[model samples]
Target: MSTAPVFAGPDAAVPRHVAIIMDGNGRWAKRRLLPRAAGHRAGVEAVRRVTRAARALGIEALTLYAFSSENWRRPAEEIGDLMGLLRLFIRSDLAEFQRENVRLRILGDYRRFPTDVVTLIDDALARTAANTGPSLAIALNYGAQAELTRAARRLAERLPPEQIDEAAIEGELETRELPPLDLLIRTSGEHRLSNFLLWQAAYAELLFVDTLWPDFGADELSAAVADFGQRQRRFGGL
Candidate 1:
């Protein structure tokens, strides 16, 4: 692996932490005349591919928006399919993750899932807890607004208003365990945050790509990272 700084610097070639909104699985399925479930399955494959690519590229952390809190509003059947897919992914990939030294982390309140799903997630988290490789954070049942609200409540309960500053609130966030977000990518040509990492993205570079989640792979990821390298990030300065 390349020995490069994960944090922002004048010569940083790869982001230390990268977050992705894996969007358009359903649309990809519709375009192919396949069930949305199939698209999601393919999306899982993409996840595997991208995880390996990120690790190979020397990224320290990768965050994926797998499922949102609002996803509960989706149809029950679709939700069930997604849940099943999650179980399958964890069961099939846990060993590989361990072998690759990937640390699995959940960014949202995953306990709200079905008992079995929750059990599987907890098992995965524990099993990979000791790994020192790249961190992979899956955002299941996550929402940026909700995260911020919960962080605020936690701070309010522990500290007075005067002491509740940015650092305190960020320390309360789930992402505090992960690296500072350096690059955020949204796929399927969408150009929105979609309630993800609002606080951590304060100075992170944003990239929108037309590739659907399932179609995303190493090449696309490398291209995006290359594009990111070419841009001059002033971080709101001249």
Candidate 2:
């Protein structure tokens, strides 16, 4: 709902890529004495809100940490709920994504999911493959350490040690095509990366907010972008 441009000032620089670690869904449900599924449902709404806000704010790419590889340790019922939510989101939002020209991209090896889920995800990806609009990347069953290890292994398999450099390793990673990550945000007062985008965030402006994921909305996202615009980023040169 915010009409303010993300780069409000003359000198404000818009971040090319923004990554978020959406946190506190269980906490939010616990606070309300409701089921965790209720909180995750609310969090999905927040995702929709933030996705629209990011595009309106002129962000080229937005990456959301939807599910981590470690999340498989949770109870089967909770995992089932999450998978159901994923199916619901894709079914409900695929049309909106096409209408808004938003490209959907998955950052992890999502093929290992259930057959139906993988089919749905593949269909979405193929449908949006040609779109030129802002990218919305979801990290499901993702782990930065695992991603890095995979990249390294790929490089070692295809290239000689002399050719295995930073760029080569990066090219093998999932986000190789996205712009350099300029900003990373974590909500729910958390202060850790929790295995999210560790390599891409090497120089990103990290912001930790107290608002829970279910409660985060367009206004909070806009405020974070505005705050990021005010900082000086020298990328280790200043």
The lDDT per prediction is 0.90, 0.90
Per-residue lDDT of candidate 1, residues 1-238 (tens digit): 1122334444557878899999999999999999999999999999999999998899999999999999999999999999999999999999999999999999999999999999999999999999998999999999999999998998899889999887788788998888888899999999999999999988889999999999999999988888777777766666
lDDT per residue (tens digit) for residues 143-188 in model 2:
9999999988878888889988777877888998888788999999
Check candidate 1 and list the clashing pairs: none
Clash count (model 2, backbone only) = 0
TM-score of each: 0.94, 0.95
Candidate 1 Cα deviation (angstroms), residue 61: 0.3
Q: Lowest summed-lDDT stretch of 10 residues in model 1?
A: 1-10
Candidate 2 residue 23 C-alpha distance from true site, Å? 0.1
